[model samples]
Target: MSAQAHPPVVLYDTTLRDGSQSEDVLFSAEDKLRIAKRLDALGLDYIEGGWPGANPKDDDFFRQAKQLKLQKSRITAFGSTRRAGSKVEEDQVIKGLLGSGAQVITVFGKSWDLHVSRALGIPLAQNLELIFDTIRYLKRHVDEVFYDAEHFFDGYRRNPEYARQTLQAAYEGGADALVLCDTNGGTMVEDLRRMIGEVTDLGAPLGIHCHNDCELAVANSLAAVEAGVTHIQGTINGIGERCGNANLISIIPNLKFKMQRSLTLDDEDLTQLTAVSRFVNEMANRPTQKNQPYVGVSAFAHKGGIHVSAVLKDASTYEHISPDLVGNQQRVLVSEQAGRSNLIYKLEELGIEGVDAKDPRLTELLLDVKELEHQGYQFDGADASFQLRVWKALGELPNYFELLGFRVIDERRVRKDGQHPMGAEATVKMRVAGESVHLVAEGAGPVDALHKALSKALRRDYPMVTELKLEDFKVRILGNRKGTEATVRVLIEWYDGRCRWGTVGVSDHIIAASYDAMVEAVKYKLFKDKVKPV
Candidate 1:
């Protein structure tokens, strides 16, 4: 079907609702409001706020969400059907949804005969009444009512007749959309496509909600759309219970760019895909997957020499789509496996100009990278250190400060409470602007003490050095067999208000490795900001 002929697929985000069920994820009410506003900016059709009566956090979210001014998305309040044998008007769940002040209401009810009988301990016919009553009652108060048929796929496989009857009840009760949910997330794509077709005769607009247990959530969601469903529900970055919900981050681009399906998201909103994905992860305090499809850091990164060479000439040779289309950029990584093309591409990316690819110095620089990587120096994660090497190779590196010597003393003492407390002190000597300076500092640990001492020694001549703050420090043992004596590689990430950069150092002594990485971080900041010596 032509893109214009088919209706634009509605984007429903449940990150605030289902996504909070993920392991160790706790989004404060403030976090949900912020996420809702961001999703609204990204042009989502519906944002599922959460179940208002389920907990105090969601309750607070709904209370504060009243003040949020969203431009494009409708806030949805989710809840379950009224309890068995209870009046829909009197049910607390129903009352909570009515009081949530959301623009839409979505209620899920049992579709599986097993859940109706075993879980709810209610007859199949009574369960249908509950589904019909909850959606019917909510429809009177709200303009839109989306009915979620929980466990519909498995229920359909077990008792096809009962699943259809459940959906029919919701449709007859005036639901605007009937959402078929794969609660267990185990449905095969072929089975989903075939079953979804059978239910279309009901004449209700269909939606698809999927989980990722079998890792087919995205695939199954797309299959449903191809089967003529218009509404697609998912979470940002696919975070939810068990595996996760379907990832809209992957689904959005696939629908817009690959499957040629029209989406409610505009072309401009498509560009915010990566930023939104990362923002959700940040709020959840979860580590981002660097290899995640379109939004990952490694999605467009080329590591192989031949691949980099081809991509440098024409990106389409190795890329499936322009990374710019998703607000990402292609990267060439330098490593022991790097060829001349990798070096040239990386140097150009770092904005270091005037070096010819055929220059003899270029060959030497490539060999130096290989030799250093062989010694446990990885340039891929330490771009700042690699840029420094490029400057030194070009003979344009200036010495802003000279490290003369340093000493560290660590001591442990028993407190009155019988707790052992350790203290560390560092003394650093350096030459700055042709003057010798010595400073002593104490810190929580040896690395912190050294960083403080170095800052004190350099801050006189290089005042901007105060801007550099060590954000992260990681140490990896290159040779595990030697245990404590093994060579360690230290990577230090520094933030100087504007941005963050990483530098790497390798040595047998942990303190020396840390000090070297710290020095490289300072040097990179000085060079990049073009701070001249006093």
Candidate 2:
């Protein structure tokens, strides 16, 4: 069939209502308001705040949102249709919608015959009546009313005529829009397309809501769009019950840039999509998905030799879209799998360039680093300090400071015959700037002794060291088949109040690796301070 001549697509974000159902996601009423304001800034067409009658927090959210002057998006209150055998005028849920002060009201009614008979314990006829009466009542109260036919796709597959009748009920009841929901998240893409076509043939403004049980939520939403649906409903990060609702984070750009659909925002604002996606993830206290379609951190990162080389020639060779188009910067990851091009790219990012494409030494160094990385050293995540070490090893780095010598001593005594126990003591000495600094301290362990001694020695020359501390320390055994003879790799993450950096060290002895990582951490902090004037 020829594509229907539909108006520009509208994005209805359910991040607050549906997204909160995500496992481990529970946003307070205040957080909901904060996210609502941010969603408004991102130019969402509609925001489904929450089910106001379902909980006290949602009620408070509606009350709070009424005070804000959101210019672009309308606040939508979500709820279920009137209960079976209840008049719309008497249903408490319908009354709550009337008092919510939302211009748009979204209510879900059962479309699946199974849900009608089993879940709601009502006859199919009463289910259709419930949908009709609820929509008609909400239409009288609000200018815009959307009827979410929950399980519309599954219902269509099971009882196509009954599902169509439910849609007919909402259409006849004056629903401004009808959203077909894949409530179980089990519908296939081809079925979704055909079903959406069937509904569009019924002559109502169509919308699509899908969950990610089969990991096809984004594809299903897009398929519906391809089938003449005008409204797309989903959460930001595919966050919802079970798997999640369709991720608008993946959908918006696909629609705007790929399908050539308009999103009611200008191109300039569209560039902020990636940033907005990250901002929402941050507010939700969840790590953004690394491989998320349009805006993930690794979406545009290249590591393989062939992929990086091709991407350098033309990003379209490997990337679906330019990173800059979505306000995301491209990255080259360095690991055992990386090639010379990846190293060169990383070195250039660090403002160092001496190796050439055909340099024999470049290949030798790459192979050596890769061999080392295969043993658990990740230089990609620690590129700053890794590059510094590479330059130092190549005799290209200027020596700003050199470690003359260092030592640590610990003494402990135990009481005997009721005598008091003598305290333990540790001492460390290091020479810097032609001056020798020595400090004696007590610690419960060798690692603590080393940390205290080093900090004491460096405090005079680097006062900022006081602000730095180890955030995380992880030790992994490399070549475990070698047993106790295996090498250990240590990763230390340091936070210096403003920013964080990671450093790595590998050695047969764990203490040695720890000390090496410690030295790199201090040097990295100093280097950053010298270069950035912080």
Candidate 3:
């Protein structure tokens, strides 16, 4: 059905509620408010704020959220349906939901007879009463109430009649939306399609929530949408309890562009998809997956000669959709497996013009890159290092600074003062412009002390160094060599507010490797600013 024929698909985000169930994905009350506002700005229909009274954090989140002026999305207070024997008015969870000051409330109730009997240890009939009375009761207090039929797919398959009865309770109770959930996330798309058809008479707007255990959450959600379900409930990047919820990042564009279904996200909001995805991943302290469908770093990256050549001529030649459609860009990656087109595309992307594809420097650069990669210097994740290599090949970069020498000392002692103390001291000597600068500093660790001393020395000559800061540092032990002989690979990520880049270094000594990566980071900063070393 066309979007004009049906209502725009409602986008319900449970990131603060269901997403927090994910392992290690806790968001403070402040984080929840921030994300809620962002999701609202993204044109979402509902933001499930978390279970009030379930925890102090969620309670405080609702409190703070009420104080903010949300523009579009409704902040939903989530809770479980009232207990089997408890009166809805006497339920503290229901009271908390009312007090949450949210315009909407969502509660999950047992849909599967197995869950009713095994988990709640309640009779099937009593579970239906919980689903009915809880939503019916909340409908009086809240502007909108959504009923979540937990494990609806599995329950429907196990006992189709009982599942429909549970949904019937929700429909009779006046739930604005009846959400079918794939709690186990194992239901196939065809089965979901079939089940959706069976539940059409439940008497509420249908929604779908899915987990990603079988890696079919996004597909299953889409299947439900195709079968006439209008609400799509999921989390950003699919981060949630088990595998995760369906990925809204993948689903939004899929519905808007591919299926031709209307969604809450407008053109501007759609363009911010990649940025919003990265922002959420950053808040979760998770690495953004480079291959994550539309928004990933490698989503539209091309490396092969034929692919790069065709892509450069007409991106539609190999790309299923324009990268910018989802706020992602086409990338030409240069590696040992790449061809002349890769070099040309990359150089042009970097704004290095006037170089022919067959230029000898291009061959030299590719050869050097392949040899370095063979030596364990990964340029793929180290974009700054790759840029430095490009400048070196193009003969445009100059030595910005020279590291004369450095010494690190680690000392530990028990003093007469009855104190056991440990400390690290680093001395750095570097030549900037035409003068030598030396600095010494102490830190909790050798790397920290070295970083301090380096910063101290560089800030005097290159005041712009103040803006350059290391965002992340990683060290990997490479090879089968034993003890100190093992190769140390250090990768450092640097950011100057306006941009961020990564560099890598490999050496036998950890400190040496770190220093090499640190130097590359500084060089990248200078290179971007059009500065060169004397």
Q: Which candidate is the best by lDDT?
A: 1
| lDDT (Cα atoms) of all candidates against the true structure | 0.93, 0.83, 0.88
- Report the C-alpha lDDT of model 2 over 1-534, residue by residue, as the tens digit: 212344788899999999998887889999989888878888899999999878999999999999978878899999999987778899999989888999899999998899899999978898888989899888887899999999999899999999999999999999998999999999999989988887777889999999999999999999998898899999988889998889888888888777777678667667787888887788788977888877887889998987887877888898888888778889998777888778788778877787687776677778777887876677655665676666665665544445654455445565677655434344666666667777766666565667777788777777777777888788888876587788998888889889988888888977778777887887777777763222
Residue 39 lDDT, candidate 3, scale 0-100: 88
Model 3: residues with Cα > 4 Å off, grouped in runs: 402-405, 413-422, 427-441, 455-463, 479-484, 532-534
In terms of lDDT, which candidate is stronger, 1 or 2?
1
Once all C-alphas are superposed, what RMSD does model 1 give against the true structure?
1.6
Candidate 3 matches the true fold with a TM-score of 0.92
Q: Give, for candidate 2, the lowest lDDT window spanning 10 residues.
A: 419-428
Candidate 1, residue 514: how far the Cα is off, in Å: 1.3
Model 1 — TM-score against the truth? 0.97
Using lDDT, rank the candidates from best to worst.
Answer: 1, 3, 2
Model 1, position 311, has a per-residue lDDT of: 90
Give the per-residue Cα lDDT of candidate 2 at 233: 98
